[model samples]
Target chain A: MAISEPIVLPHATDEVRLARTWAQPRGFWGWFMNVHHTAIGVRFMVTSFIFFLLGGVLAAMIRLQLSRPENHAIGPDLYNQIFTIHGSTMIFLFAVPMMFQGFGVYVVPLICGTRNIAFPRLNAFSYYIYVVGGLLLWVGLFLKTGADAGWFAYTPLSGPQFTPGKRSDFWAQMITFTEVSALGVAICLATTILRQRAPGMTLNRMPIILWEKLVLSFMVIFAMPAVMVVSSMLLMDRTINTQFFNPANGGDVLLYQHLFWFFGHPEVYIIFLPGAAIVSTLVPVFARRHIFGHLAIVTSVVATGFLGFGVWVHHMFATGIPQMSASFFTAATLMIVLPTAVQFYCWIATIWNGRLQMKLPMLWVFGFFFVFLIGGLSGVMLASVPVDWQVHDTFFVVAHFHYVLIGGALFPMFAGLYYWVPKITGRMMNDLLGKVHFWLFFIGFNMTFFTMHFLGLRGMPRRVYTYPPEMHWGGLNMLASVGALFMAAGLIVFIVNFFQSKARGTLAGPNPWAAGSLEWATSSPPPDYNFTELFTVNGREPLWDNAPNQPIVSGVRDDIPEVLITNSLDSEPQHKDEMPGASIWPFLTSITVSIAFIWSIFSPWGIAYGAIPVVITLIGWLWPRGHSPAPRQPALEGRWSK
Target chain B: MAELEHTVRKGEAPALIWWCMFGGPFAWACDLGFSYVLEQHTCSTGHHYVLHVITVVCAIIALTGLAAGMAAYKRVPEEANDHGVRPMDRTHFQILFGMVFSIAFTIVIIAEAVPRWILHPCQ
Candidate 1:
């Protein structure tokens, strides 16, 4: 085959074949060392889903134990472990990894019209570290010491004097592992979104999903640090008796709350924004039109990111703070709702005007609107200092967040799965089964969480394993427990539908849903290099435009996995960035980091000695490859300061 | 709306963006955080009035700096390319993103000072 010229290259199918030959890894060890965004993305989805199931099972156990008054279904000690693990696993392992890392990795490159994510090895390292982090938590659980001080891991309760042993250490270490993973990917994504977008896919013309992701990536950059600080502080206090949280040593408990909520509050947006992105991506496709308020939505997403940081204190309102301090948070929290409301209204406006095609994905969008709205309203109620005083630690708070997490994250997740699984697996999910899954899950979800609001309002405290029959709370608790069963049944239906559809569902070609995004402009489960010929996107929906096959972005060297680095605003091609080929270094580095984290749990000195392998592995990893041209200095100026 | 931009030195756009992203939030955090620190320090050290006046001045300065940055960010044009790197493409929206929060931060700082004005320091 002839090397085609940059301007008029065609024959995408031929290029696909050539790209595959160079891009695809071979067997066994090759798969482990693969750095392709798609491969790593699929792994993230799989791992997070497995963790989701594990977390769900723990949830079911909790509900089962609490179903009957004075039930001995599970002891309090084990129950504490279960609840803590469930929250930690779902938030850290399932929600953030699955939403931000998995979805962002898979779609951002394709949408940006790049061959692979920037820093591909770092991407792989993030995944491996996440896997290790998740596994360590579950392993600790099996040993019956899975961070029993709650997901927040609040002080004094989680302080050295009260909780001993490796339980809290595991929680802190697991957090370090996951956060390092999240932060690494945040950098990868920020670089990719900022630099690798195709020519003409300018800032304003870029899709809403990309904007949401850019903001979320930056959020991960800034927000994840606070948690790491708190977690490490807690670990130091426990292991070395630093007394960061101990009142006797001048460290304040509220300081922990301040730091934790600083990260914890944005953590909610970190998880929720991706779900909103999925909805933004799908709403136009399902509604049969371009979105309403495209610019407004983009601004709002970024605005939400900015405002999200200020409202952390709202979560700490229950702690005794001055009225004036609480009011500041209250105002910040209230202000954030405007941007969110803009997003919801824009979606509603788009769908109302669009030629509505209520497919499986759209159904979940509707579900998201309903459930997240309730959660949002409850959140508003909680934002008020006085209302939060009553329901801060109650099941009402439980009801609110489930509405947020399940409705906000999971509902959109399933929608995105239905929307993208075909582009992933080349098969449409079963429509009938999808509907059954949605309805069952939706009904069961409402039944389970909504009842908790009443149970909480009726004076039932949270984190308790059992309640007395005389409390008259058995009825609501029982109802809530039964609702969990329905949700489980619904989930089972989904699992069957998902698996069955993968092998037997109807075939989906390049654009099954007639979506306008760039991802669908190629084969259903696009080839190893994603696009055969990258497009110079002229508008938000390039495929929706009248051009029959848009112009291609050439000049990327196919032999070496080259990608075009473009200007952020106009997406004008800057230069070619060579994507690193698959290597075992990232995997090795993950092990090095994991060993450091695990050892630090027992002795702080492990971090120092651990730095040896880490530094060695990092040297090997960052060492410039032998293939590239040496850096060209201006003229012959080898000496510093000519 | 027309996409507007201004020419920048080679690497200044990213710095501008970094400021645009964090300036407002940091301002608000400082106000909130300083208030927490000042509230404790003043109450303990018996200088509540001085602490209150000091926080108000610092917040005003931070607010002005954030405001000035937002103005510069808004002026970044879509066509502004430092060499071939066009970090200014989304500068307007990013400015708006940060500006809204800057306003919110102004509110937060003002809000943070409310207790310093109305309430007794520690007793």
Candidate 2:
């Protein structure tokens, strides 16, 4: 077991050994047992995309029902359920999972030059939990027990007294499921970024996307707890006779508002920052240069994270808080604009300084700029208490958030998918099809959301099942519905291109985009081992800066799932650690947890009964096998001996 | 044992750097949370002045963080413009980022305070 200097093997033999050692189990049971980050990441993306389509169908139904004044296309009761599930699915199931969890899980470890994500089994467990959570909500919808109390599920309305049944209960427990999943992935991503970076990839050399993801993980840690707590309290009040939101029991309704918004405001950043990270990542590669003002962009991201938490009160402005409180929130909301503007300026400067290539991915970036800018401008107006008071609960407010969420998260998400699909699938998507997808989406998105501003200004209220013909809202609503059709068409084209490219598109080499990050340094559709020889970088754009002869880190055993752990700041290698391989316990544990969560809606004793199996499954998941390899001696004697 | 020596040789980030990086945000968070909670008291007791005092104290604390960042920056001035992967470059980046964050949060604190001066607490 004496540590010897790593001897280089023939490339062919090294590939074979690495492949053999890192191979996943085969067939059906193996799929459930898989814990590789890339596999789990793909599962997250595919599952969330299915939820996205389901959510889209719900949106289209809402549009059809409202296409004409007093349209009776959908009954009011079902309409209530449709809109509620639509909002919840889009925000909770699709956006966060796709933007933050899916992309983060897939790309972060690769970009950091690690063998696998830290806590790979937990990553796998998170994917299953997310799937089950999504199924619970959609199943409830199909079963006619869907949550009808809107996405936020504000108390009194969602309480047992007003909207009885298990509808709101389903919503509360779904939040618990997704939050638990999100928190798990957050810990995995944050730890991978902080401790498992390639040796010498110091903080200064870290990519902008890594910085953004790190900040995002921290935001998730701080913000998600508030939502989980409030949701649990809502459930307690409904099932267990607690009075957290019961005004007659001396429980203030405003308490729910305060707690929910604390998580809710930062949740916007939780979704948007990952989108911003995509833009930051794409700009440098397309512009063909190192990003301008790298430190400033990183600083702006951190500032945005902090400022985001302070502005939640603005969402509560029309609820009649004191003028001083309103003023503080208004100012905080306005202040958040500065950091986002700084990021925008840096992106523009980077493009200005370098030769801009309008690749397909870059085209989606342009779309994001147009759509997100309009959304952001409208948001500044909404920040003012007077303007918000006028537009409160109007179609105008509806228009504002759609512009923000769709433009900010969805647009950048499509950009990232286009940019990384080659690396994930080892094939290039059809360029003509991608362009068509972009134009239809861009045009249709503007047609649908921009018209809502007018409808809102005309006094059309949101969440109402129908409007009278005299309201004069028919023409605009019709136009918006037509736009939804076009957006739907664009999504169809994207789906066709995605699968078609995977099977028959041009074979993509390791660096299809000729990008500069570490992920590009490895093969497209990277091998299970990630890299035959781990990389050691000297600069941010390692491929471009170190080029042709970038240093390779050797000595981490190719026989076991060993990853090099490094110091946090400097990334100086410290010791080697083993990573867990594929297992079925994560899958089993998720089922146990899901059964408990779903059962609790019916009986209070479900939790008490559920904890036993959960504990047993968790024990199985955590139990260590009695096997240990002899420790290797230090490779570099002087460095190890101090 | 040898790996332990290697880890020891890597050293640790100075506490001043962590304080400089995070202290300003911690203060701003305190200002927001406390100000929000204290609003109920201010409205009931007619003591609007308490909010202004809290804002002033929080702003001062944020300013101290800015000063600490500046002090750290001055020590690594040679690496200020460098974005290399050296140890000094990493320190320089952290110091610069902390300074920018401190300045940004300080501005936010002051802007938040302005609303307190112009409007009555209970209005």
Top model number, DockQ: 2
Runs in model 1 with CA error above 4 Å?
A1-17, A629-642, B1-31, B40-123
- Tens-digit lDDT track of model 1 for A459-517: 88999999999988888888888888888998899889888989898999999999898
TM-score of each: 0.89, 0.96
Model 2: lDDT of residue A486: 92
Docking class of 1: incorrect
Clashing pairs in 2: none
Global lDDT of each candidate: 0.82, 0.87
Summarize candidate 2's per-residue lDDT along A1-642 as a digit string, tens digits: 111123232222266778887887779999999999999898898889999999999999999999999899899999999999999999999999999999999999999998899999999999999989998999999999999999999888999899888999999999999999999999999999999998667887789899999999999999999999999999999999999999899898888998999999999999899999999999999999989999888988998888888999899998988888888889989999998999999999999999999999999998988899999999999999999999999999999999999988999999999999999999999999999999999999899999999999999999999999998999999999999999999999999999999999899999998898889988889999888878777678878877465456666676777787877887877667788878999999999999898888888889999988999999999998744642533433344211
lDDT of 1: 0.82
Runs of candidate 2 with Cα error greater than 4 angstroms are A1-13, A629-642, B1-12, B77-82
DockQ of each: 0.23, 0.51
Candidate 1 chain A worst ten-residue window by lDDT: A633-642
